[model samples]
Target: MTEADFAFLREYLRKRSGLSLGPEKRYLVESRLTPICRRFGIATLADLVGTLRLSREGPLERAVVEAMTTNETFFFRDRVPFDLFREVLLPKAIAARAPQRRLRIWSAAASTGQEPYSLAMMIHEAGAQLAGWQVEIVGTDLSTEVLEKARLGLYSHFEVQRGLPVQLLVKYFTQIGEQWRLNPAITGMVSFKPLNLLQPFEHLGQFDIVYCRNVLIYFDAPTKTDVLDRIAKVLTPDGAVLLGAAETVIGLTDSLVPDPQHRGLYRQTAVGRPAMTHRLAAGF
Candidate 1:
């Protein structure tokens, strides 16, 4: 790809998906878009760039964005986040909203449904604790393709093997041929939607817990700050936001502060912060 081709794609991706691609990622872009070019019958990267430039709202534009957005995820990824959820966040949220008997969770950038499904399983395991409560888990991603897969709640054997324990798999999944299908009871507990982090999210409503993990690293500093600001608007004042283990709010935004005891957990920084009476912050 020429300098101009790279420049156009970089700016286009940044504007469309808040992705900050540097010059070193030229090879990565080439590899990802080459298949897209062939699919569109375009002969070259420059030609694909021209086609995209002409029709910003075309199907090709969506294809390009989806191709570039990483959708890597699996059941109970990294372990600690889900551990913290079951042992800490869920209980606090339950008590915090006991009067309303409602619980809301947003799995921002949730890819292929594993993250939200894992949460659903945890809620199912809790059983009576959430018996009469109104629970909602909204899993949103920029890629419509992955959202469709998530809606189906089907995974290959390989997918199930990644971080999903054998006992839980046996308890929640039914074998279909060589694949595993999650029970509708669990899949019904979550809803999937198409969302762009660069856009407004007020329509999604406030949530007691928001998991915007591993998605912010793609954006530049300003975009990261802007996205965090929008997230703060839809998060309950005392709610928690769990970022990726490598991500943090320390130098990013003032609207949230890290939970001292939990590595990837954060709480809203507004006044009237909830007291840490329970040892919820002790492990994970």
Candidate 2:
């Protein structure tokens, strides 16, 4: 691709998906888009760019965005976040919503459903503690393709092997041919939808916890700040937002404050501030 074509792609991706690409990512763009070009039966990247320039919105535009957006994730990825969810975040949510007897969790940028499914598994294990609660896990991503797979609740051997404990695997999954199919008991806990974080999320309603892990690393500072601030709006006060281990709120936005004990956990600022005593005591 020439400079003009590459420039168009970079801007197109950034505007549609909030993906920030520097000049160095030219090769990465080429590698990912080449397959897109082939799939569409287009001859070259320039032709693909030409096709996009003419019809800016349609299946083609979505295909490009989904292709470029990274979907790398696994069950209980990084371990510690799930640990915090079980020992800390979930407990706080349970406590805060005790009067309502309802709980909602959002896995923003939830690639292939592992993160949300992991949460569901833990909730299931809680058994009596969560028995009467109306728990809902919403998993959203920019890619419908991945969302479809997540809806199916099926995993390849390699995928299941990544960060999944064998006991939970046996208890919650049934071997289907060579792949593992997650039981609907856990699968039913989550609902998947295609969402662009740049767009408003008020329609998703308030949540007890929001997991936007490993996602902001793709955007520039301005976009990252915008996304974080918007996230603050959808959270219930005292609601927590969990970012990727490498991502943080410092220098980006003041909508959230980091947890001293957890690497990726942050509480909503101002009214969303953590009620330390109330939060720690609600582990039931």
Candidate 3:
């Protein structure tokens, strides 16, 4: 692809999806979009860009954005985030919502349902302690394709093998031949939606915990700040937001501040509530 075509794609993705593609990432663009060109019978990336320019908001445009957005995720992909949820965030949310007995968690970058499903599994493991509480998990992504896969709650053997404990796998999943499907009880606990973090999301309602892991790294500094600030508006007064292992709120926005006790967990300072004093809970 010529520099002009590449620049067009970079700006297009950044505007629509908040992705910042530098000049060095030309290969990434070419490799990921080449298949789309073939599928559409377009000759090259430049032709693809020309078509995209002519047909904004068409199925091809949507497919291009989805293909470029990284959706790499697995069950409990990183141990620490889930541990933070079970040990610190969950107990904190449980205590905070005891009066209303309703708790909501948002997997903001819920790629294919693993994170939310894992949380539902943990809540199920809570058993008696959470018996009477009303808990909900909503998983949202920019890609409708992945969201559909998530709705099905189906996983290949390789998918189940990644960071998923065998015990929980056996207990929560049924083998469908060589693949595993999450049980209805766990699958039904969560709802999926199509969301663009670059857009308004307050309509989704306030959440006690928002897991925005590994999603913001693709954005530029300004986009990161804007997304985090908007996220603050949808957080419950004492709600927590979790970032990816490599992501942080420091120097990004003042709306959120890091939890003193955890690495990736953050709470909204925009609400004027005092920082939560976290107590580590039992193992999951």
Candidate 4:
């Protein structure tokens, strides 16, 4: 890839998805776009960029977004958040929102849908305990292609194993050819959509629990603050927001207060104090 090709990709991705690809990730850009270049019959990355510039809204642009946004994810990528959901968050949410029996959950960076599906399975296991509950699980990603795949709820064996409990796997998934298809009951539980966090959030309603894990690290501090602020706006006043274990809202934004009991959990606080510092205990 030439400097011109790199410049095109950097600007296009930043404009379309708010993802910044630094010079060090040049290999990543080449690796991701080689097939694209081949498919378009372009001899070089620069040629592909020229073709892309001339093209309007069509499959080419969509392919670029998909290739750049594609990420590796699997069932319950992190165990602790699900554990907290079952043991503490769900119980508290269910009790607090009892009369309404309404709960909304969002997996903001939900790649291929495993996190939301895992959540739906947890709720399904609760059964009559939540018989009257109106549970809404919404999973959104920047890539529409990935969102469609997530809605299908089918996973390869390797994809199903990462952080998923053996018992739940046996109960909820059925063998189909080489892949395992999640029970429709589980896939049917979630609603998937294309949502870019870097843009202003619109149309989508608020939620009681927002899971935006492992995503902010890709963004700059200002983008993180903006995304976090937008997330806080749609969250219920007392709702909880969960980020990746290494991610924090303390110094990144002031709209959240860290939950001492829950790692990566933040309670919506009024916007004013953005410099708070925090330290996490190991294995939380």
Candidate 5:
């Protein structure tokens, strides 16, 4: 790809999805978009860029943006976050919301449904603790293609093997030919939607927990702060926000602060101050 081609594609991706692609990612851009070029019968990367420049809201634009967005995910990824959920976050949320008996969790950038489904499984494991509770898990992603797969709740043998324990697999999944289908009870607990984190999230309502993990690394600092700011508005007063292991709110935004004991957990700073003393006493 030429300099002009690279620059146009990079800027287009940044504007469309907040994906900050530097000059060094030229090879990545070329590799990802080559398939799109063939699909559209374009002669070269330059041609693809020319076509994209003409129409920002065209189907080609959506294809290019989806091609550039990384959707790497699997069940129970990076175990610690889920561990924190089961042991600390979930119990605390349950206790705090016991009076209302309602709980909501949002998995931002929920690719192919594994992350949210994993949360659903955890809710199932909680059993009687959430027996009378009204629970909802919302999984949102920018890619409509992946969102459709997530809604289907079907995984190949390899997908189920990654980060999924054998006992839990047998308990929650049944084999259909070469693929495993998650039980209806687990699938019914979660809902999938198409969302762009760069856009507003007020319509999604408030949640007790928000998992926006492993996605901010692709964004510039300003975009990161903007997305975090929007998240703060929809979180319940005592809600917890979890980011990727490598992501943090420090220096990015003042809306949230890291949990003292948990590695990836964070709480909205303004509302969290009064709860800090109580959280410490509860060993959270």
Candidate 6:
């Protein structure tokens, strides 16, 4: 792609998706858009951009966003988060919300549903502890295609094997041809929806825990702040926000404060903080 074409597409994506594609990302755009160009009957990236410019409301624009959105995920992509969920977070959350009998968890940017499914498995393991508890797990993503896949709860053997513990696998997955179908009991625990981080999210309702990991690294500082601020708006003040191990809240935004005991876990510290005593008392 020419410099001018690159600049135009980059700006277009930023405006539409809140994702900043810097000069270093030029190759990424080229590699990802090449197939888009061919699929749309365009001769090159320049032609594709021209088409997009002429018809912003067309399917091509949606295709561009879908093509650009990254969907890298695996069963328990990073093991620590899952371990912490089972060992610390879930136990605390269950105890604290016991009287109220309701718990809400959101997997923001949940690609292909692995994270939410992993959470469901943990909750299932908790068994009678969570009985009569109103548990809701909502998984959202920018790409509708991936969200649909996540809702289906089906994965290829290779996909399921990556980062999945053997015992859990045998208990939760049934073989279906070349892929593994997640147990219905586990898959039914989550609800999937399409969500764009660039937009307001207060309408999604408040969450006790927000898993927005592995996504902010794709945005510019201003975009990151905007997204985090919006996240803070819907998060329970004492609720925890989990980011990727490589990501942090420091110097980026003041919407959250790191949990001293947990790596990559940040508890919302804004005014009117919700009671975390229950979670703390549970040894979470």
RMSD of 6: 4.3
lDDT of 4: 0.83
Write the candidate numbers in order of decreasing lDDT.
5, 1, 2, 3, 6, 4
> What digit string (tens of lDDT, one per residue) describes model 2 on residues 100-185?
89998999988899999999999999999887899999999999999999999999999999999999999999999989999999
Q: What tens-digit string does per-residue lDDT give for candidate 4 at 56-79? A: 878778788779875777777778
Q: What is the lDDT of candidate 5?
A: 0.90
Which scores higher on TM-score, 4 or 5? 5
Model 1 lDDT tens row, 121-188: 99999999888999999999999999999999999999999999899899999999999999999999
TM-score of each: 0.94, 0.93, 0.94, 0.90, 0.94, 0.93
Which one is best on lDDT?
A: 5
**Lowest lDDT block of 10, candidate 6:** 271-280
Worst 10 residues of 2 by lDDT: 271-280
TM-score of 3: 0.94
Write down the lDDT of every candidate, Cα atoms only.
0.89, 0.89, 0.88, 0.83, 0.90, 0.85
Residue lDDT tens for model 3, 1-284: 89888989999999999999889999999999999988878897878888888856878899899989998999887889889888988887778778888898999999898999999999999988787898989999999999999999999999999989999999999999999989999999999999999998867877788999998999999999999988887777788899988899899899899999888889889443322221112110
The alpha-carbon RMSD values of the candidates against the true structure, listed in the order shown, are 5.5, 4.5, 5.3, 6.3, 4.8, 4.3
After TM-score superposition, what is the CA distance of residue 224 in candidate 6 from its true location, in Å? 0.7
Error of 5 at 262 (Å): 0.9
Between candidates 2 and 4, which one is better according to TM-score?
Answer: 2
The number of residue pairs in model 2 that clash at the backbone is: 1
Candidate 1: the clashing residue pairs are none
For model 6, residues 51-137, the per-residue Cα lDDT tens digits are 877855767788898899889998888888888888888888877877888889999989999999998998998899988988999
Error of 2 at 190 (Å): 0.4
Model 2 stretches with alpha carbons more than 4 Å out: 271-284
Residue 252 in candidate 6, Cα distance off native in Å = 2.1
